[model samples]
Target: MKLYVIVSLWALVTITHQIKTQDNCVCEFISSEKPFPYDKLKMMQDSASNCNNLMSPQKAFGLESLLLGLNRRLPQLEDDVEMLEKEDDGELYGVLSLYVIENELTEIQAMIDKLNSSTSEHKRLGDDTAQKLEDVKEKMEELETFDAMQVMKKQQANQRLKRDLDQCRNGGLHPRPQPTKHTEGTCPHGRFLNVTGPRVFTTGEYPGSYKYGAWGRDPKPEEGKESWHWLVMLTSSNIYAHYVRFYSTLSSIIVGVSTPGNVLIHPSNPTTNTIQGPNVVLYGGALYYNCYNKDAVCRFNLTTKSITTLQLPKGTRYNSKANFCHLDECYVFTDLDLITDESGVWVVYTTNQDFGNLVLSKVEEEENQLLSLGQTWRTSFPKSSVTNTFMVCGVLYATRYVDKNLEEIFYSFDTTTGKENLNVGIFIDKMSPNILSLNYSPLDQMLYAYCDSKLVSYEVLFEKRSNFYL
Candidate 1:
């Protein structure tokens, strides 16, 4: 009986040893297929050798806690497996649980790597965006500085013009010629001869007859009224004459004669009293003329046989010598010019208030009588030396005092934008006698000029078309 009991005890001990060996085998397999490298733990140890020297204290603490927790948990798992091996049924369940934990750990590590890569790309993009914003800010600041400088330059130029106008007003300029004789009659045809030149030859000569009149098509004509009309002006003197005979377009005989009730004789001179400038515009069945040897604009009603005068600003220069002079002649007493466009009549003149710069005022009238002035715009062009000017769509174009044959439309001022353009290369192809007066007819789309003693016309070509002008 003793010999059999000794043999039983030895077999039990051998079974227990085999179970412990089986548990160890399972642990070894897991460690060999580790999701996280064992050497990474050693690298972490070296990186956190001095906690005080870490750049981010919070991040370093987190890494240290993770590594220490992993080290402690791995040893606890081994101990638990050893203890389970001693039981009859617990060994199989513990091994299956460890396999699931290993898969979960592998998935977590992959997610961490992906998150880190995304964070790095986003940071790079943010930095680029910030740099672009800074560059744009700098460019905007530069543009503002340039605009301020331009304003300063414009102010200085205006100051200089004021000083020059003062000199002109104080008898520093030459006086114009005085009239020699005054005669009242119609000038016979062919009395005022037409002088031909290259400009006239190339563009066809002037019309056979000098239609001494205000000629234009009415914007809104009356029923049965002709679309085109001409109001002829018969001069009192053969040379240096004043318009005394107002002839109707319907007949060659005079009409709307300036009786005492309608004629506003000049305060200073009466023998040769007339509108100061040659430019006369017909609008709304009325005649608009510049009368200010000082401060007045005159309007004559064709139907009512009455005259109205509108007062302009003080210190308006009227009798100054020609602002624009050529090699042969200087236009005399050209201070105010009347211009008509699609909108209506406008007075182009200069004033002391504007520092001698060109001022454009829209004519306001009611019931064929002068009422008030509309909106006014100031141009940078000095009113002194403008040879001739015309309006197209509220934009003012001026010719220089260059050679009459080679005149150019070199300056422009836009009323809407308040912008001025210089050095424009539009050449005036055909002009005669220095273009004493200029007008653009929207109806016929032609430019009309009173050159010397003749009326000439030219076709206008524009790069862009605007409805505001026509």
Candidate 2:
């Protein structure tokens, strides 16, 4: 029984050792399992080490070590087999990873060099294109400047040709018409036609004059009733030559010449000879005029045959004396000023009321009583001797006799600010002989000055302003 008991104890000990070995195998796996970043092959090696320490004897555990090593290495061998699944996930490792990164960086450097080369080439191409564009711009500017110069030259040549043509026309040809022909006669349409003076050509010197020249009045267009007629005022003549029937598209028409009536008491009595006048605006309705022995503004209504005097503010040298001393124009102001489309008026009588102070007044609304005078503005120079006034762009322009040499200076002043834009100088550099009368035409956009016997016209081109500036 003792022998049997010893054998039983030995068998129990062996069973317990086997149980311990199994538990250690399981515990080794649990403790040394590979982390997520660890390679399977490397994890297998680590697991092998743990197994040897836990279950192997100092030399080698008999079958147990072999079995345990097999258990650990089996998974590593399987992992090696599945290395095809590694897929080079491109994560950091040791020297091998560093070497791979350096190679990639070298390739990137090569690509960067290519990109830089392409960029530099593109920039050079862009610079060439820009240079070509600048050349085109300069060429265009040159062409424009050349075109402008040619236009100016052409205009000057044309002016010279016209002057020569006028000279040839006036070089003397036909003898004087019979004095009987000078008798007052009616033109077609029952319009009265009267000749004020003979047509004479002016050239060199003449007697009893600062300048030798002929004086006459004729229609500007010499056509229809739509044309304007002039009541020309000549210098030598004491009266304003009233050309009865003259027609023209130009505003410088000579309708008549009459004296501005002066208030002179009769030598014998106080209230004797009341002032009378031939002064009448053909368009303005006529009213019998005699303001304290001086002629007042009177219009004779042709359609109604009724005359009426314009009621002007009273209180001047001769109160109620509506004498347009130096009449400048009697034409439509539409084309001249470019303001006809709006509420505008037809201006007449460019006169210097207070010395050289220019007075530009007009009589509008010929047929209606609703018509009245528009705004009256002041000018820069004194009106003592301004022969003509023209309005452009809401500004008043006047031609004043600078001297007896007929050297005239044209100036403009803003009606609103009452200040002068001194930039514009005297336009006349070539015009000599004093101008007897002046007028403007919107249709032609020309300034016509009647000097001596010659009728001259100046082309006036206005500058275009930007809409933004306006």
Candidate 3:
């Protein structure tokens, strides 16, 4: 029996020594190079722990060497991890993590299998051994949960990236449809020079059902008038308002010039009463207009004959005060606001006295208020004064007569800045002089001045030389 006991002791020692040597060999191999094989490193670590009795100083040195190798390759490992994240390789990461766990668990399983295969007469393991087994099992479960979570996160990130790319290609924010040429044509006189004036019939011996047409005739140009065209057909000379004119850029249209005759209005519920110029603006699928002397902003629904009116301020010239103020001559069409917001129509008008006092007021939802003085500015010159009432670059400009020589002066003012542009003038010798209107066209980036009852357009030609007004 003693001999048997001695023999068993010797076998155990030999087995322990052999395992130690094997672990050392593995560690030595791991420590040899960078990008240490993680799977192999993990196996060695597990082997060293699984059979601690086999460990020796040389094996310990080998284990330390493996740790050093891992440290050296740490930066590379980090790069791999980052790349993995960018690529959304959750499955790969999970697989690697699982491999490490499986290697450890497999070691435990091998030991368990060895214990099971041993003779029944052999000694049993202690409580500590059983506890270690249970711990390993718990670690495997945790790893499984971690793997699932990583997979879900990667999938979500991938979906978000796809959505962002799609938005970039589709113009996520301000998607605008491309504009196409409308061969069918717009208003016959070109895009109707949008006007805000009244419609009156021809008086005298002209017989017609609809005696007159709305003025501010922005008709498309005719084919032959490209060089110097003329649209002269005035059904009536009685222009109650100044909103009856528009100029065309395209020469392929024929806008009728004034015809020799009288003007009249179709009698209606309001007796088709005559008013001032039509205050017209095209916006939101409708033409907004108001009678020359009426105290209301009227909307003529082209889609439907439905006429809607919004009340103007009590002080507007559209009332009896307007006729009297006009020296009993009646107010004519003035100008319409180019910009339309939810607030209401912004109309600028001239007083009948011609002293050059311009009024700025808003036709709100249903009320009008003469804008305060601070909100308005006027331009004055030698013999004439004009209100800088028109808008360009969100700023308003007004012109005035500097001399009887027809030298004209203009000033630009910012409604928001309250700053004014320096006075500037254009000179053309021997030309009839009249400051009909000044306009800016955003489409062509040009500024126009109407003088001598004719139009002369100028290229603004330079950047705002100075925001001296800034």
Candidate 4:
């Protein structure tokens, strides 16, 4: 009886140990592809009840190892839950802020609607009041009558005024006076001369001056005209408010001419309205200039009184801060220059693709539109190295920007022969140090220059001897 009781107790102990081992077999649960939800800390307490049944002792041992590994990572899982809770709080705050904003927007919309209704009411009342005023005016007009004596007096006064106007038109009472000529002195070759004064409005003593400006002669002067006409453009920091002066050989004074008078004012495009460069050429009864802040040329017709624009080739640089310079200083002007010679008008400019070389194009007018004839040429030197350039006959002459007191004409390009010569050594000693403009006149055989805010003329000695066929 004692042996039977001891065996029974040992069997019971073995069964209890097996049951406890089976309960801890959680390998299937821990090895799942999906993660266990540790955010729900209450659910984690019931994890043991959700374990799969053990198939073998080895399987149970593997499950026990997996559960041990998972137990070690419980602290990390708790940290994750805390982070999730913080994110939830942030999202909740954002939603609350959005709700508040929506409410404010609703109130603002309601106020706007109310204001609109009030405005409509006021507008209706104003319309009614206007109608009543119109009716009152009509009633007053109906009651008014014309006076015969007053009418007769008005007719007599009108007749007298008409007679006076007719007499004025016929030059009966007032004889038409002829324009008086104020000749200070005559320039050489009967050229109209002007005293040194500012052509543009400036702050200091040099108001209306062309210190850094451009001047050129009319390429096609009118027939039977004794003197040549020249156009001068003033330079300013403000590119839009540029001033132009019309100088004729007939007048000794520089007349300030605005758009529609000297230049055509561009209505919608302000960039094309003003002239920025120091190169204005008069050709075929039209003034050609470099448009301000644009890579195009502007043609202002003197007869038609209109402006036309001609687009230049792509990559042509103009209106840039980089201007011609020499040893003393650099003059900030335009990159594109309009030049006219005995042949016609040509545009001188530089392009990025040309590798800093100068490009020239012959311009022609057809049907009131300016067109390029595609007769283009390339110069040997870069445009930046040239201080000033002008066309004589069909040849282009370039002066050095350095040693302005000693004007050295070092470069020349012949459009006819397609030959470019450098270091020609031709010099003009009479030019000032600040010679912003240099133009050769084919008519007077003279070189006109705007040097140091004064107009100076130099006689061309080579005009008769040159082999140029103008």
Candidate 5:
């Protein structure tokens, strides 16, 4: 009996040592040589208690690795949930987020399964910690059913297909699509093939005095104004301008002609209707520009000398929220860009509803002689990604700075086909650092760019369409 007691103590010590090694080894005591008396069972129980005390370190080793992986992922999941919860119907976060959460949860579930299997015969975690884990799992399940993305998707669809409020008010459900393109064959210049030659270059009268402005001939000129060239210099803090100076002829513009009776946008500089931003167009005997500190476009008539306003869509990013940018700097207050091509006049902008993507809208003159917004189309191209944009033959071409001297037109959004072309690699030779405003003239087939303090124009090369061919 004394020998049995000594052997039991030594066996307990050996079992404790083996468990400390943390190897997959089972520890148990069974005498096969003979049937032990019932009295020996109590002694074995005491031995088991001593072994458990010595092997306490083994328990930590079992769960520490699992907790580390779980620790790394839970915090990340928390961060993702916080951001996702911040989304609303106005923002666009779609099913992409669900996929990310599903991937993370799937990995965590596998770890949970392994943990359950390993701890089946023993309590690996205290009751409190296990309860906390169960709570986390429940939260994850709730997160899986989050509907913010669904709401955003539906809201986005509604906004994308919806057009101007003016059209809706004029004609109820199924309003007529606003006119965007002109007669295809009317442009004798044909489909644009390439951009070549800085056909015209001039430092306007202001020259270095102003670093940002717009210069071009009016596509729809008033009678006797067909030979006119216009220049608008943002004389106040490079953002607000009150007047537009006109040069009689192209040669006069090159010779630095002085102004005679400049068209005033507003009486006082930076007033209510004054032009804001560097992008403005002189079209149809009027100057179109973004209104001062507002998301609406203002048309200041050179003839009637009256002002008309056309408010842009809701959430339009004015006040420089969506400015054209490159590696160096962004052109400030370029949020509402106005450009002219063969297709009358168009406004380019971005809205929060569209997730900061480019939106193009047409400007129409109602029979009442007031300006009303026409059709609006949202494009997939992000507005903040490009440095400048222009329209040629009714196709919108977007450019980015290729180098200090080269600006490349790499994207085109064709509204006619409802398609976007990203490989339109047309390059512009820039004489200055950046092109603040770009405009296309159908009359001369020229592309004009307002670079820093210089006015540069390029000849648009094109192949005559087969229908328009001789």
Candidate 6:
């Protein structure tokens, strides 16, 4: 049997089916003689995109108008919970507040039920907030059975973890070096005054994939690589990394056009000497970082492929026991922060004996070229209160998160004078919400901040001074 069929759908597409053969009929549809117009199909796709881009100011697409203040009300409930949580004697007032919280929890549940958002982020936030609200309500109801002080302490810790998790879903330092007689040689500039610019900003090769990292110029870089920029991304579970990425120049990183060279800490990752946090810094020709899950620092020399370890005090915190935190988030496993300054490399950390206050130690290379900790100092500033810390001219500057767009340096600990100033008050205009790793490079006189997943640099503005009294 032989058959022929041709169908033309109006202003759309055409199809032809034909069968011609004796025994086993062969069918030939659209052929080279009359090919489908792929150009027209592409033009239709362009038109569809244009329609998608069309805009109309309409309230029907969102939930607030339908629910009469769903957006306004949800935030209020969250704020109320935070406000109550911050009160020193939270549980002392808990008995009276529990009823109100209970009412709020019920309302929150009702809101969650009423929400018809197809957005996964909205649904997840509602579900998670409802669960946490329920848990917090239970704790508030039971606060009567517990001691207020003990409950406060526990709540502080719980609040830290809660902020930590919510951030998982969402999301200083001092100076020091000894002074010399000549102002040009030592402490030439006055105290750190201000910071400006993203002087440089880039996502690099990995971009949004990496949320924790550090990037900067190695102050005393190896001969030819002096112009190179180094990046240490905490590539494993946000806890560790085994390689350092190298870019030839700053522009190369910003443009993200060049292939970066990688130097592996170990051929096998999570083995000995793997970097534990984003606080690692490259100084000279060596990379200094926290020893994996240990109260120690590891220096991996790039030229020699050799390593050196410096043990911290017995009570020193490691393995996420102490971390850099702000109201919004905590950078975990940051127990040991390696920093570099004009003098040399330094380690900023906290210890149990110090009650979680910042401890600074100088990392020195002895005559034998071995690294060791020297000149131990302690500061009254609590580590948990700060979002990050860095050093400039032997002065430790500490920053607390003011908001997503701002970080305020409200504290400075001068190692030489053993003086603490709570009014340093220098503010950084941030491009991202968090600065996980921060260090100052005397080589460039710039501050490098690994802000969330982005690498940003700031010019360290100093007060001009001709001479200084050592």
Task: Give lDDT tens digits, candidate 4, residues 1-470.
Answer: 68999886665444322223744742221221234334433343333222221122223332232233234334434554555556555677656655544543443343345345545655665566566556545643432333324665688789999989989787787442221221222223231221111111111123335466555456567673333345454645523324444532212122121212344344333454566666666676677777777788887776676778888888887666446667667666657777766667888888888877888888876764756556888876888787777777677778885464466677777776777777466565533566666676666455666666545555555412442311
Query: How high a TM-score does candidate 3 get?
Result: 0.34
Please give the TM-score that candidate 1 achieves against the real structure: 0.47
The collision pairs in model 1 are 183-236
RMSD of each: 43.3, 48.7, 38.4, 42.4, 29.2, 27.3
Candidate 6 Cα errors over 4 Å, as ranges? 1-186, 258-260, 465-470
| lDDT on C-alpha atoms for all candidate structures | 0.52, 0.35, 0.35, 0.55, 0.74, 0.72
Q: Write the per-residue lDDT of candidate 5 for residues 83-146, one digit (tens) a residue.
A: 6667633444735565556755665675566556646534533444456546555654444355
For model 1, how does the per-residue alpha-carbon lDDT over 207-321 read when each residue is reduced to its tens digit?
4333223334444344543333433232322112233233212111111111112222333332322455566666666667765454677776656646688877776766653
Question: What is the C-alpha lDDT profile of model 3 across 73-163, one tens digit per residue?
Answer: 3443455456555655567766775554444344334334433443221223334445655765565554445453477568878998987
Full candidate order by lDDT, most accurate first: 5, 6, 4, 1, 3, 2
How many clashes does each candidate structure show, in the order listed?
1, 35, 44, 6, 0, 13
359-443 per-residue lDDT for model 6 (tens digits): 9999999898787789988988899988788878887777899987778778777777778887766677776788888999888
- Highest lDDT among the candidates is held by which one? 5
Q: Model 2 residue 443 lDDT?
A: 35
Candidate 5 weakest ten by summed lDDT: 176-185
Query: What TM-score does prediction 2 earn?
Result: 0.34
Q: Which segments of candidate 1 are over 4 A away from where they belong? A: 1-223, 231-273, 292-294, 326-328, 463-470
Worst 10 residues of 4 by lDDT: 194-203
> Which has the better TM-score: candidate 3, or candidate 5?
5
109-186 in candidate 2: lDDT tens per residue?
433453455456556655665665565556544444545347756887899998778767766343222212111222
Which sections of candidate 2 miss by over 4 Å?
Answer: 1-237, 240-243, 248-308, 317-356, 359-362, 366-371, 379-381, 385-387, 402-406, 416-418, 429-432, 464-470
Give model 5's TM-score versus the native structure: 0.59
Please report, as a residue range, the 10-residue window in candidate 6 with the lowest summed lDDT.
176-185
What local lDDT score does residue 445 receive in model 3, on the 0 to 100 scale? 32
In candidate 5, the residue pairs with backbone N, CA or C atoms under 3 Å apart (3 or more residues apart, or in different chains) clash, namely none
